[model samples]
Target: MVRITNTIDIDASTQQVYAALRALDAYPTWLRHSTVYRGTKMRTPQSGKSLSYEDSTMVGRMRGEVVEDVPDHALQFHQRKPSGSLDALIRYEVSAAGTGTHLTRVGELTTHGMLHIVQPILLRMAAAESERTMKSLKAHVEGHPI
Candidate 1:
């Protein structure tokens, strides 16, 4: 498994940050990548609720589902290739940081078949992607570009 993590502080309340996290449709406006919510089953993210969607990444379209949702606290999602060769886990932890919010993100990827051979490459890309996502998310919640 390859793991990568990143953190950022957004100048907004935890409620503000959590609201932005659940706003799937507004993702394309600030996210570095594209996550198509056109087919998402859960209109509102909540604990135990299933989330399903497809995202455009370096590896092409990938499907994912929400595995955990703790309102205003933590959120986690899992992704895997349609062919069942690769699995990825992404999670976010949110907390109140004075007048703003502290966000921590972690990403883990496990590869099967031939993907294991390129685990090192995936690690690098995942780290970069994680950073970009954090920065973009911070900006998105803070209501200005970072």
Candidate 2:
């Protein structure tokens, strides 16, 4: 498993930022116009809620789930290929920073079988992806002016 962390401070309250994160749909779509569908009955991103997504990107098809959700604090989501090729766990942490919100994202990805050979390259790619996602979130939360 490899880990990458990205942080950004948004000019919004922790609750607001957290709400936007939980909203999911508010975040701008990226990488092949992937659409996320929540398969759980709960409206809130509580634990055990699954988000299944099919992206024509690198992974092709993947299954995702919410492992943790703490209002105004943190949210953790996990995704992986059904064939056990690629696995990623994403966690977002939010805190109050000078009346604004400090958001941190931790991304961990593990590659298996044939993919394991290219894990280093994939790590770098995932790191760039993490940065892009965080920037998009910051921009979206800041009214698209950032």
lDDT top scorer: 1
Q: What local distance difference test score does each model get? A: 0.76, 0.73
Residue pairs with clashing backbones, model 2: none
Query: Compared with the true structure, what per-residue lDDT tens digits does model 1 show for residues 1-146?
Result: 87788889989988888878766656667775433222222344456658666666666557777788899998888988887777999888999998999999988899988878888887777787678778888877777775
lDDT of 2 by residue, 1-146 (tens): 88999999999999888987787544434211322221222234446545433323464656666678888999998878889999989999999999899999999888999989988887877787678767767777777754
Per TM-score, the best of the predicted structures is: 1
State the lDDT at 124 in candidate 1.
76
